[model samples]
Target: MRIFDVAEITRNIKEMCIEANYSLTEDMVSVIREAAKNEESPLGRRILNQLDENMKIAGEDQVPICQDTGMAVIFMDIGQEVHWEGGFLEDAIQEGVRQGYQEGFLRKSVVGDPFGRVNTGDNTPAVIHYQIVPGDSVRITVAPKGFGSENMSRIFMLKPADGVEGVKNAVISAVKDAGPNACPPVVVGVGIGGTFEKCALLAKRALTRPVDQRSGIASIRELEQELLEKINRTGIGPGGLGGTTTALAVNIETYPTHIAGLPVAVNMCCHVNRHAVRVL
Candidate 1:
């Protein structure tokens, strides 16, 4: 089996942290541009243009697109054939986040405690998820999740009979409840059919998928499109100024579940939607 160095992982994570915060992905950029053109409200179109300019400026200056640089959330897919060397994988990832935030001048938003909260100083102890697969290569994804939209996320337990219509209403209700606070023109990630925790995770994973990419499953793809249309019709608009461009995309990820229960989660992400991935 091939041996991989934790230092290598650390190095990559550092760069990813900086890059994701500063650079809006190409797919996201293209989608926003299209949204601007299609936005029904004059104010909505103008807001989208301003957002585009903001992205351009951030990239050119190599500065964070948002002041809330966000808590570091990492996802790793490690090949079973590979062995780790050099240091503990968990520590290495946190070190990478620390160095990235310090050196890149990204804000440190993570806290040490939930109730009696204080800054973690370096944004240490990243929220990391690991998965094992068949190959020798490792894939790492860094997604900085700001709290604005995160705070608006919700999970619902629906009866098995609730089905598609229930899922639709729950999603719409969550967005409506969020109003402008979660940041309009948001990306909605819907996780369905899994257990309580798994469903929440499915929603988070959904956000990592490219906004333009639809699920391979035909029925799921149709549902995504339907949800997108209905969410935009809410008229939350750009920056919540009142318009037809409330949400940019709706993504759904599902898993097999028990016969008696249906769990659904809605994870909201603002237009920034910052995420970066690397494989080694």
Candidate 2:
């Protein structure tokens, strides 16, 4: 069995939190550059250029790419053979978030209550999801989600009769309705076939996949491509200005479900898709 020290985990998580907010991942940057090349609208190309500039400035200045630094959403794959030493794993993760945000100068956005909404100083308490997997390494992914795009997310349970076309239509409609609200040129993550809650989970999980990786399932892969084409065809462009690059990509993830239901969920991310991952 391998033992991982809590202090090392905390330190790595803190560094990841700060780095993720401050810099755009190279893969994401490459995808956006490619999208900008194919974008036909003059304004759309201009917007993409500005986004590139923004990312560059953020990195060079060591500042967050977006004003809303976002709530820290962490996903952990814990190896069964690895034992955590020194502290509770969750507390260590939260402490990492608190120190990262405080020292990085990232904005604090989490609230104590869903309704009363008291600011939770330090952004303590990250939203963490854990899964057990084989091996001795722990893999951590941190995705910081800003409110603009997250607020426009949606989930629906449709009859199985709705089928693939139904799922496609629902996603298209969701993006159409989201319109300017989701901050255009977004990444769309779709989860299908699971229970209502599982579908939502899948949708978020889809976001963890690399932007360029194609879905392994042929049908779902086709759907992802179609959705990407259709969403960009919406002309939502960057920051909602009219253009052909409304969405950079569409990702779909699926799982088996009951015979009677087709649950679908969509999670959106703005141009600044802030996420980082580490394996230890």
Best by TM-score: 1
lDDT (C-alpha, whole model) for all candidates: 0.93, 0.89
RMSD from true fold, candidate 2: 1.0
TM-score of each: 0.99, 0.98
Write candidate 2's Cα lDDT for 46-144 as tens digits: 888888888899989988999899999999999999998899989899999999999999999999999999999998679899999999999999998
Query: Top model by lDDT, which number?
Result: 1
What RMSD does model 1 have?
Answer: 0.8
Error of 1 at 64 (Å): 0.5
* CA RMSD, predictions in order: 0.8, 1.0
